[model samples]
Target chain A: MNTTLQQFNVEKIRTDFPILQQEVHGKPLVYLDNAATSQTPTVVIEALQKYYREYNSNVHRGVHRLSHIATDAYEGAREKVRRFLNASSLQEIIFTKGTTDGINLLASSIGRGLIKPGDEIVISAMEHHSNIVPWQLMCEDRGARLRVIPINDDGEIIFEAYEDLLNERTKLVSIVHTSNSLGTVNPLRQIIDLAHNKNVPVLVDGAQAVPHTAVDLRALDCDFFVFSSHKVFGPTGVGVLYGKKEWLEKLPPYQGGGDMILNVTFAGTKFNELPYKFEAGTPNIADVIGLGVALDYVQQIGYDAISSWENELIQYALKRLQEIEGLRFIGNAKHRAGAISFVLENIHPHDIGTILDREGVAVRTGHHCTQPVMQCFKVPATTRASFAFYNTKEEIDLLIKALYKVIEMFS
Target chain B: MDELRDLYQEVILDHNKNPKNYFQMDEATHSAEGHNPLCGDQVEVFLKVDNERIIDISFQGHGCAISKAASSVMTTMLKGKTITEAKKLFEKYQHLITAEMSEAVDLHEYGHLAVFAGVREFPMRVKCASLSWHTMLQALEEKKEIATTE
Candidate 1:
């Protein structure tokens, strides 16, 4: 409904993603799996090609011309990430494999450093396994406790419950900014403020959020935030982890390797400063460069336009899906972004996924790596359709039509 | 579309909707839990084996149609068969679903399970179709360990 979204040309946007132009199973591809990974724009792909073709060399410690070009582009990507997240300095941005790697780095470095025995780590029930497992492992290792904040039936985290769990012993609160399985966008600003009140640092898993919403780290003031490049139309195998300067400075380096070491001897090794300390061996250079261009591409389109357009798609999807008899939406939170999960009576999500795939409507059907959320919903799994800015009303209609076919086949 | 229809044949749908021998067998001589972590599909196979013969078999769990139907067909077919005979049938069934067998091979040997031959086209669903049978094998072996179709 926004004027900017109204004027936005979706057909042109679709053209940017070459994969969307293809047909699957004799029907036009209807890609609705943005939460898993978004289709890459040609510009991002071109950036990757240019990097490999023009200047391919290992970053840092190399004095050669190609190395300088590669290192400049690589570090430039870090600066791009810093600017994208609105962080204060490049020291805050650490390159990672993806969200999983980022969280593991923090859990190993900070979790091992600060967390003492009997300390408590708080996380929400709707967290992806990446967010949940790393903290669980940390708690297990440190003899600390991992406490989960419960969610309502609507999939929103209960603020009152979260407050009750926050105490002096609560050392850190790691939660998802937006749930991957459930589309609920947590009240992060309030959540951060609440944790800050208890002097507990919070790490936000923003893998799902960065793709769909506008995230300003300074504005949110969360201690740590992580997201993957592939989810934002960039290359896979690369992501960003943004930590507060104070936290990054205090935590020990995660992996000890070439880039992270200042000096090494039989006695001990001096670790490099903030960002480099966390980044160990050679990072995904080409993908990191591609990620920078991906961020620029998203910025070019603007988040306001993206969010507005995706919201329209979600509303249209929800309304049309509601018309199907016996269809139950899994997460119906008041505030949602990117994805919608649901189940039809007496039908398995896998079967639905198969039938939909035959119709060329690509959707994810499984526990979505949130088994606890699936158990909370009392279903083995739910079929999920995640939207992007390029998805249109026509695609929603196709999805609805596919669902009808699923129901007919099952019945 | 033909592959889809074959995968979800009428027989599979009927068994999935109303799975035969789908109940808890408290007095079972052997039992094993099967799990597919990928999709959260769980199956518990309970067998009453007497003198190397499977006198009775039943299953209890929740999964997709392929898995549920496969479990139903497995329970029905394994009953009244000797342990050695059951193992042979299991091998043949596994081959039927997983391998590209010649058309000359009589699928009637697999009976109700021939419907699942379509699963050969869907490589991912093979695990779903075989979860219960794998658990059944574990139960027959009297293994206490949980069977995981990882």
Candidate 2:
């Protein structure tokens, strides 16, 4: 409510990035690859610099003053994440290497106890390899079967198929909140409710969602949510896994090294409680503090303003992209967000990516780590232009101008 | 623009649009499928060998202009050549693309392959330019494994 149109300044937001201020290849850089990773603002960068410059020490175990500082900063970041998702308690939040690692942590730890030989795990066709492979690996290990929910041509999930997939045998339903390759914003609440009716828990991949729009885990009521910090404008190699208290308590520990233990002897080892049970080894201390600052940055801007501005940018981008001859959009979901994928009639996506790069227009080319989506669409890959709140309509015009040069050269 | 033009020359563009020997050989003595996992671009190289000589060479796949044109040009240069000669040419081509352009690469030794010299400027795309070549090598060796431009 505080972020009115007057308070929400696009130029001020653009200044926060500073990476976009420079030239890439003889022209100003137009960075539109937010889905893959958002640019870190000065606040986040300074937070990281301060951590390493001021207090560089191991956390959780050290008895020294520096270690206490590091531990508090790291734990404080976890509280920020808990608040960011609006989860019930700090015990629900677990630090992970990234989204892929978070999913792997759940799949390996949960699959051991819950997934039986004949059980089935359901996932959508639009899931990234990160969300898909871990489940496949877990299912293989447990002799469980992996089931896929089909998608419509628009890259939206078919609710009927999803409903059909849920039954007594279904153990978990994992789906992406916003597809990275296609800008499809899935109906997470509907999905969670359907799974809950059958006593099946759901895991939401919010890597593409949390950055573009607001996400409240308490409201959605999903059992688990995973996302990468880098995708949310924080440092890379950091992510969070939020699980309800019951699920976190039920699942076993993920990895073991330093920390994550109450006691260790020659005979047995007693694991720690709550979030620490899953967090093994010395965590990414500096980056974790950086993530806290990043969350603060996002919360300060207010998602209300961020959402409206990004919606306008996406609409403008879609309209401008349509003006290009032979360009066909890959996804047409009614509730899309952040990213847009399309292919030039006879040109491969990578080729378009290459030409665009020369003009200082940065867009993601290739599969975007969603090969199944690529296979379903019957295209080798698509050139995806994903946006952040820092992006402007003027930047979109630059992208369109660069795209015309692509046509001129290739035509 | 000069660098972009260097990467996508007239010959490369023509070859991409109207590739020679661009088909699946039903009776290929040897064939190999290649994948650029990063881009999901796939290519298949088929070869008909008679007495250690490549009687005919062809390629069919889905890929970007650089990859497709590279395959097309490779097929054009490979047909009717002995396996040893093909291997020698591939070795030279690999060096040509990866070598520093600042050192003044001899275009005479490269010919059509010299167009890829621009790839040195764009290091990320070097794999795209060499995917088909690696697959062709795999085909010649009769390796059943799918080749990858890792």
Candidate 3:
């Protein structure tokens, strides 16, 4: 742990995000829904504006000056992503619509090629629907089986049970790196090692992890990783699918269109190399550029600083919220990140969310696309308050204050 | 802020706390489940219709204050009303909540159900307040499919 990085100046950091300055319902906005999507910084917003205002042109096609600039910027964003994830090569990073699109691409392409009838795909119980549904569709298509690795009461995956699920028949393992609703920081290093031991590939959904922690693909050695840009303070409609080069080469092309083809013919067409083969059609150019800048922004602030600040905030929040009568935390994983989910006694999360909104605090109220986890916890839904570096202890105080009001209103 | 007050009025809150006719009707002639997937609000409405009249109505499920209260109020207003009369009331209640009517409608016409007229102010929660009523419609029509506030 870097002590210097731990000294995060949150007040100053909040200045970069212009939207954080606004008020809601006559009170200053207290945005606690970072898990859904983070607030965009001015630099990222400016990057988007600059792309459209200046040399806006279709990438990879023209020899003209504007096209050259656009193509360079677009490709440059890929390089930025490669460095951000510490991937060995640019071919490993594929731009996607978001985490869902990335997972779908991997499932449709790699899954279609590898999965056979009776073959099993192992996923943890805490996976979001985005990760689960695509695999389910792939399994349905190929007559494959979907096996779930159950979690402990604290929402952390039982490592021994996960190991028990892995065998020669297990074709692939997909897991969430950090749970969006529960905030569990899974043991990905150990998980990857276990899967690798069984000669099985793993695809880690890092949508909720990327914003709070530093992810080094080389260190984790996951076969594939996916995350959304919007969740990391970038523009929406763009994400990354980081795949090891060997696996990407083996997978079939996700979609067929221009730029994805090397040679087109009346009878048969040849596909392009690694990343481009998966990224079919014209992509979200401006948002990709914005994502690159957002990565740079996070890098400058440093993940250590962000993680340290957020850890303190969560601890403080948990303590304060525990003081409230009958409030129960849904996930109490020893290792957690980004979000905190809880249910107030005899009060629905929706009611609490509505009251919190009136107090100008935004929180996500529901199963959070992890209905399986909700079922595991035996709750209809949980109220989640996810944090970013820009969020403060003051905001947590406001949330606690508003929660008291919810109790009063319901009582 | 007044909109918030109207949305969570005392009447609505009371209904949510101690909902009336909130039991599964085992001998119901018609029944349907309503689900608001976005919020995980689920409601099951049961109706016992006799000679074009609603002899008994009850609901069972879990949801927010707005949804639970709406279901409670709906069961109270639906009992003893003719099928045609229930349909008309449903239409009028829908009109009041959606605020689609050009002319202002009298709250007295809706009686206790008028408490939900304040829901018109909250566009997002309109679904919450209407989930049970929509399920009630499905139950009355004897639709075998589940109703959703999508």
What are the models' TM-scores? Answer: 0.98, 0.98, 0.98
Tens digits of lDDT, candidate 1, A1-411: 656545788988999999999999999999999999999999999999999899999999789999999999999999889989999999999999999999999999877789899999999999999988998899999999999999999999999999999998999999998888999999988999999988899999999999888889999999999999999999999989999999888888888888998899999999888789998898899999999999999999989888888888899899999999999999989999999999999999999999999999999999999999998989999999999999999999999999999889988
Candidate lDDT values, in order = 0.92, 0.91, 0.92
**lDDT-superior candidate, 2 or 3:** 3
State how far residue A223 of model 1 sits from its true place (Å).
0.5
C-alpha root-mean-square deviation, candidate 2 = 1.7
- A1-411: candidate 2 lDDT, tens digit per residue: 334446678888888886878998888999988888889999999999998889999998789999999999999999999999999999999999889999999999889878889999999999999999999999999999999999999999999999888889999999999999889999987999999999999999999998988888889999999999998899999999999999989988888866899999989999999899998888899998998899999999989989998888899999999988899999999999999999988888888898998888899998899888989999888999999989888899999998888888888
Tell me how each candidate scores on DockQ against the true complex: 0.88, 0.93, 0.79
Better of 2 and 3 by DockQ: 2
lDDT of 3 at A200: 94
Give the fraction of reference interface contacts each candidate recovers.
0.88, 1.00, 0.81
lDDT of 1 by residue, B69-109 (tens): 99999999999999999889889888888886445456777
Q: Check candidate 1 and list the clashing pairs.
A: none
lDDT of 2: 0.91
